[model samples]
Target: MSTVVEILTQIRPEFDFSQSSDFFEDGMLDSFDLVTLVSELDKAYGISIDGLQIVPENFQNVAAIEALLSRNGVVP
Candidate 1:
Protein backbone atom coordinates (compact mmCIF):
# COMPACT_ATOMS: atom_id res chain seq x y z
CA MET A 1 0.00 0.00 0.00
CA SER A 2 2.83 2.38 0.80
CA THR A 3 4.43 1.59 -2.51
CA VAL A 4 1.24 2.60 -4.30
CA VAL A 5 1.00 5.72 -2.18
CA GLU A 6 4.59 6.62 -2.93
CA ILE A 7 4.07 6.27 -6.64
CA LEU A 8 0.83 8.21 -6.61
CA THR A 9 2.41 10.93 -4.50
CA GLN A 10 5.29 11.26 -6.89
CA ILE A 11 2.88 11.66 -9.77
CA ARG A 12 0.50 14.09 -8.07
CA PRO A 13 1.53 15.46 -4.76
CA GLU A 14 -1.62 17.56 -4.42
CA PHE A 15 -3.88 14.55 -4.70
CA ASP A 16 -5.58 13.17 -1.63
CA PHE A 17 -4.14 9.74 -2.27
CA SER A 18 -6.06 8.20 0.62
CA GLN A 19 -9.10 8.23 -1.64
CA SER A 20 -8.00 6.57 -4.85
CA SER A 21 -11.45 6.49 -6.46
CA ASP A 22 -11.74 10.28 -6.43
CA PHE A 23 -8.76 10.81 -8.73
CA PHE A 24 -10.82 11.29 -11.86
CA GLU A 25 -13.97 12.68 -10.32
CA ASP A 26 -11.89 15.40 -8.70
CA GLY A 27 -9.96 16.10 -11.89
CA MET A 28 -6.67 15.28 -10.25
CA LEU A 29 -5.18 13.74 -13.36
CA ASP A 30 -5.74 14.49 -17.01
CA SER A 31 -4.62 12.97 -20.33
CA PHE A 32 -1.15 14.45 -20.22
CA ASP A 33 -0.92 13.27 -16.66
CA LEU A 34 -1.31 9.71 -17.89
CA VAL A 35 1.42 10.10 -20.43
CA THR A 36 3.88 11.48 -17.91
CA LEU A 37 2.91 8.82 -15.40
CA VAL A 38 3.40 6.04 -17.91
CA SER A 39 6.83 7.32 -18.77
CA GLU A 40 7.75 7.60 -15.13
CA LEU A 41 6.46 4.12 -14.40
CA ASP A 42 8.36 2.65 -17.33
CA LYS A 43 11.61 4.15 -16.07
CA ALA A 44 11.03 3.62 -12.37
CA TYR A 45 9.64 0.10 -12.62
CA GLY A 46 11.49 -1.15 -15.66
CA ILE A 47 8.27 -1.98 -17.50
CA SER A 48 6.93 -0.73 -20.77
CA ILE A 49 3.30 0.32 -21.12
CA ASP A 50 2.31 0.44 -24.75
CA GLY A 51 0.02 3.01 -26.34
CA LEU A 52 -2.91 0.62 -26.46
CA GLN A 53 -2.61 0.09 -22.73
CA ILE A 54 -2.98 3.78 -21.95
CA VAL A 55 -6.70 3.84 -21.29
CA PRO A 56 -8.87 5.24 -18.53
CA GLU A 57 -9.67 1.74 -17.36
CA ASN A 58 -6.00 1.14 -16.70
CA PHE A 59 -5.28 4.51 -15.09
CA GLN A 60 -8.48 5.77 -13.52
CA ASN A 61 -7.21 5.51 -10.00
CA VAL A 62 -4.38 4.44 -7.74
CA ALA A 63 -5.68 0.90 -7.37
CA ALA A 64 -6.01 0.59 -11.11
CA ILE A 65 -2.53 1.94 -11.61
CA GLU A 66 -1.17 -0.46 -9.03
CA ALA A 67 -2.94 -3.34 -10.76
CA LEU A 68 -1.42 -2.35 -14.09
CA LEU A 69 2.03 -2.20 -12.50
CA SER A 70 1.50 -5.54 -10.82
CA ARG A 71 0.47 -7.10 -14.13
CA ASN A 72 3.76 -5.89 -15.56
CA GLY A 73 5.70 -7.43 -12.65
CA VAL A 74 6.35 -4.02 -11.01
CA VAL A 75 6.64 -3.97 -7.24
CA PRO A 76 3.58 -1.79 -6.78
Candidate 2:
Protein backbone atom coordinates (compact mmCIF):
# COMPACT_ATOMS: atom_id res chain seq x y z
CA MET A 1 0.00 0.00 0.00
CA SER A 2 2.98 2.31 0.46
CA THR A 3 3.36 2.24 -3.25
CA VAL A 4 -0.09 3.77 -3.39
CA VAL A 5 1.29 6.70 -1.47
CA GLU A 6 4.10 7.02 -3.94
CA ILE A 7 1.63 7.04 -6.80
CA LEU A 8 -0.53 9.64 -5.08
CA THR A 9 2.48 11.77 -4.35
CA GLN A 10 3.47 11.60 -7.94
CA ILE A 11 0.02 12.86 -8.88
CA ARG A 12 -0.32 15.60 -6.26
CA PRO A 13 2.73 16.03 -4.16
CA GLU A 14 1.30 19.07 -2.41
CA PHE A 15 -1.51 17.11 -0.80
CA ASP A 16 -0.81 15.10 2.31
CA PHE A 17 -2.14 11.67 1.46
CA SER A 18 -1.46 10.32 4.97
CA GLN A 19 -3.59 12.70 7.01
CA SER A 20 -6.02 13.40 4.22
CA SER A 21 -9.38 11.68 4.65
CA ASP A 22 -11.82 14.17 3.20
CA PHE A 23 -10.56 14.02 -0.34
CA PHE A 24 -13.83 15.14 -1.85
CA GLU A 25 -15.61 16.93 0.95
CA ASP A 26 -12.60 19.08 1.74
CA GLY A 27 -12.05 20.02 -1.86
CA MET A 28 -8.77 18.22 -1.99
CA LEU A 29 -9.84 16.31 -5.03
CA ASP A 30 -11.85 18.17 -7.57
CA SER A 31 -13.05 16.94 -10.96
CA PHE A 32 -9.67 17.48 -12.53
CA ASP A 33 -8.06 15.85 -9.52
CA LEU A 34 -10.28 12.80 -9.94
CA VAL A 35 -9.37 12.54 -13.57
CA THR A 36 -5.69 12.69 -12.76
CA LEU A 37 -6.05 10.30 -9.87
CA VAL A 38 -7.99 7.78 -11.92
CA SER A 39 -5.41 7.90 -14.63
CA GLU A 40 -2.59 7.36 -12.17
CA LEU A 41 -4.43 4.61 -10.33
CA ASP A 42 -5.17 2.84 -13.60
CA LYS A 43 -1.51 2.86 -14.44
CA ALA A 44 -0.14 2.15 -10.98
CA TYR A 45 -2.60 -0.53 -9.92
CA GLY A 46 -3.33 -1.87 -13.38
CA ILE A 47 -7.06 -1.44 -12.82
CA SER A 48 -9.34 0.86 -14.69
CA ILE A 49 -11.52 3.15 -12.57
CA ASP A 50 -14.43 3.49 -14.90
CA GLY A 51 -17.45 5.75 -14.57
CA LEU A 52 -19.19 3.08 -12.50
CA GLN A 53 -16.68 3.46 -9.68
CA ILE A 54 -16.35 7.19 -9.88
CA VAL A 55 -18.68 8.09 -7.07
CA PRO A 56 -18.37 10.64 -4.28
CA GLU A 57 -18.42 8.02 -1.56
CA ASN A 58 -15.95 5.72 -3.28
CA PHE A 59 -13.30 8.34 -3.88
CA GLN A 60 -14.02 10.43 -0.83
CA ASN A 61 -11.06 9.28 1.21
CA VAL A 62 -7.93 7.22 1.14
CA ALA A 63 -9.54 4.29 2.90
CA ALA A 64 -12.48 4.40 0.57
CA ILE A 65 -10.26 4.64 -2.46
CA GLU A 66 -8.07 1.84 -1.16
CA ALA A 67 -11.13 -0.30 -0.53
CA LEU A 68 -12.33 0.28 -4.06
CA LEU A 69 -8.90 -0.58 -5.39
CA SER A 70 -8.69 -3.68 -3.24
CA ARG A 71 -12.10 -4.83 -4.40
CA ASN A 72 -10.78 -4.85 -7.94
CA GLY A 73 -7.65 -6.74 -6.79
CA VAL A 74 -5.57 -3.66 -7.36
CA VAL A 75 -4.57 -3.03 -3.80
CA PRO A 76 -4.05 -5.59 -1.14
- Candidate 1 lDDT over residue span 1-76, tens digit each: 3466677688889877777685666788888877888888888777898778889788887778888888887767
For candidate 1, report its TM-score: 0.80
Q: Which lDDT value does model 1 have at 73? A: 79
lDDT of 2 by residue, 1-76 (tens): 3466677677778888778777777666778878887787887777877788887788777788889898888744
Q: Clashes per prediction?
A: 0, 0
Alpha carbon lDDT at 27, candidate 2: 64
At residue 38, candidate 2 shows an lDDT of: 79
Model 1 RMSD in Å is: 2.3
- Residue 15 of model 1 has an lDDT of 77
